[model samples]
Target: MTAPIALHGSNISYFTGKLENYFRVKGLDYTLHAMKFPGDGKRIERELGVYQMPVLQLADGRWMTDSTKIIQWFETEQPTPALIPANPAVAFICYLLEDYADEWLWRPAMHYRWYYDEGAHFAGRHLADEHLGSLPVPGALKRAFMRHRQRSGYTRGDGITADAVAGVEAIFLRLLEQLETIFRSRPFLLGERPTLADIGFSGPFFRHFALDPVPLEVIRQRAPAVLEWVARLWNTRASDCTGSEPDSVPTDLGPLLEAIGNEYLPYLNANVAAVAAGKKRFDADIGGVGYRGARYSRYRVWCLAELRRQFEVLPEAARADVQALLQQHGCWEPLWQEKLLPLLPGQDEGLPFRASTKMVGANETV
Candidate 1:
């Protein structure tokens, strides 16, 4: 018998919650280990060359990093109870949503945690203690520093400032409303079964919305449907397991799709252009608010390239469907552009094109 896959991460981590939830839903043979920061530093750094969590150790002993890359491996290897949509256009939409949720929502997610004092104190202290409770430093100091780091990173690096806060809050409010409305109709984001899109959302939804104190209060009060959906995903069994209908998108999910087109895609397009222009700093007009000073992210830049590549490879009918869906929701242009977005080929070793199959030649099981 093969060994169980080893997942190293913490519940406090957003991406970690995502991978953990997915594993439970699939009943995959895996064991979870808390990522020890100070104690396990050497091994963690050696495997990833950076302190990244939710590392997956394949049964054969090969290791992998990056949540999306790991999910892509599962999509290719374990076809049963598929998280990815088989329809090319639907699959493309899933990938796009995954990318946006993974890369774009980092700012809002970080902001919500740090903006309100209640959440700020809870998450800040909780995370620092969970990861570094064993460290010699006082817990209060670590919390204070982490709180500052989380807040400033968004304020300084992701361009979240006084001017942009309103727009970001607008996104949060609209998202809560839209998701609540969808949940009123269906259990999962797409339909019955949880798709990669649902998992994408779970990164923020589970960690921030469901867990954080302030947002949790907001979710419980303002969006009970949202809370209900969260509870559903947490359970091993859910009421809506009918799965998505073939070649279809859920009508209830239109608002989210629209938001993606209107808000997130604009920033992505601007970032894509910025990366191509070889600029050190990038600027964007998000929701009519001007945001500047965030440096280009090689990982996000690669996300755009990866998405366009997926779109480019779709079949004619599938391409037509994707175009129509995106166009209807005001998201066609950025992705529909003729020129491929630039990718960081040499500079980026963070996320690979795919998992390594060379070492396990003639066999692909994880």
Candidate 2:
């Protein structure tokens, strides 16, 4: 008998949307358990050793965290209808692009949802109040819940300001322009078929840009073709494509990863920093990478180190290709290295990539 696949997530979550798209694209059999804000869902997630949702509770009882990890797992467990391309170079590029969409694109998406949209702003607060009502707390609990939500970096409710909203809008428009250039010639980001890049990007494009009324209007007005592509990707069913999986790095794939690490990754990081720091406004030009106006504390260092480690593990030839790509993309210089500090010892070293081997006797509380 097959093990059960359960997903714990909320509908309002972009990450959850990404996971759901993976399930649909992979034709995986699963159940989605909707969770209320500030609920026991996080406690269940902690017990299972997963940090965040859309967690995949595997049949053997092991849990998987992060949408990217879960999608990779699906590629291994069900090889048909491959989300990744057969060519290593193309596949690596697709993965890197997907990472950009998932990580950097999030800043603008969050800013819009929590800060710009009045309906979402109040609704989120109300949702928090309802979730906290389940507890036996006394007076001023609602205010406390609001404060807690503000502090939790995961919440989309607190990181809003007029400047932030403008930044998000700028990022969105820039991404659309880049995507239009990429997709105008090809149906997918790669060439012919939908790759992991398409699936990965579909989540944000669907939820924040395509669905959100304000951003959607902006996308429609500025880049209708990009919006069209978003629709095309979402409407696709897994059964429509010829399925095949790329499990190992192909020799030719080195250049792609190298390009991503050297050029795209650095660009992305810098762009994010600009937004967080308010050094640069979030516009089409600023959409490359880096969180502006945001601090590069422990969490930022940990994430960057993990990414570097993943890049380091690539074949030496692949590393060279990445270096070359970075140079080509004009990303050879280190711009934000001064602001970044090293992570504390014993911090969580969670890379976005993982192997498919299933461990027996893993916990599954959530």
Candidate 3:
């Protein structure tokens, strides 16, 4: 038989852990290859056009980057033990929550990995040793540089300032509490089986928050059940249980959704504005702390666009229910209000987009 598909990423990566654990849960046969970073031809920038980890190379040699997209690819191939729900409302909620976990949770994950002296040192050592091992650079030099680079990047990237510590900490603690509450009853975020929602949350929880030495201790102390779920995601198989039910989003998931709306939406709004304004970065206040994001992100904009598109196609009753739930959790306005507009005509508009009005315009296209 052909070898299982290859996941080119390191264990220390957030999305890597997300997809790695997901493949196991889905019962897909896959092999893990440590991704080489910086000047390595094995997974170079020209191939991916970006420096990112956790790309899945398919059997025919096509590379699939972006964690959410990869999960969708699996959905098409498997379809049983489905990662997304059948109910339009629940499925759409999974899309938004998955987007939340994929994009927004990166802040806390990065903060934990790089903000502290111990965590930074620990992560830097692992990153350099793993990804930079075969490079011409000296081990000590690369390790120190990696340490400084990641910490500085995270600090500036996520607005991890001294004053921002409390807010970030609050998010981490609340997430742990909510996961514990939900997992105490159900096996996964959505219901009886693992879904996109579980994989989404597992991204940060498995690698950074739960696995990192510093945050792992915090998790163990405050919410050990969260850790158990992470382990379960890594160890369980699709056949282990049936899956999430149709037409339902668990009541316990409300806190998780509320946190997503409370925290992630604001940052997403700023990024959307930045994409529209043709600026590389935008300012926003998250957790009451001011931050200037490093740059605009097209993928995240696409995530919002995809959610809106999915919501638009749902049946009327389902749409209304989903919108109401979003409103209750504080997620409706931004997504519903500012739609992703068309690409700039005759060019790859390097910029992201938001519709000028409610309707898709003559210039509009996904």
Error of 2 at 112 (Å): 1.1
Q: Which model is ahead, 1 or 2, in terms of TM-score?
A: 1
Query: Candidate 2 overall Cα lDDT vs. reference?
Result: 0.56
Candidate 3 minimal-lDDT segment of 10 residues: 357-366
- For model 3, how does the per-residue alpha-carbon lDDT over 1-366 read when each residue is reduced to its tens digit? 145978888888888888987888888888988877555434444555444666667788766666766787678767877778788788888888777777777877888888777888888889888988988988889989887777665665545667777777788888888888987887778777777888888888888898777889998888877888888888888777755475687778788877767677767667677778887666678657667544566555666667777889999999889888888887787665566543334222211111111221111111
TM-score of each model, paired residue for residue = 0.88, 0.70, 0.88
Q: Candidate 1, after superposition: displacement of residue 19 in Å?
A: 0.7
Model 1 gets an lDDT of 0.72
Q: Which is superior by lDDT, 1 or 2? A: 1
Q: At residue 277, what lDDT does model 2 achieve? A: 58
Residue 220, candidate 3: C-alpha displacement in angstroms: 0.9
Clash count in backbone of candidate 3: 1
- Report the alpha-carbon TM-score of model 1 versus the true structure: 0.88
Please state the error at residue 9 of candidate 2 in Å.
Answer: 0.6
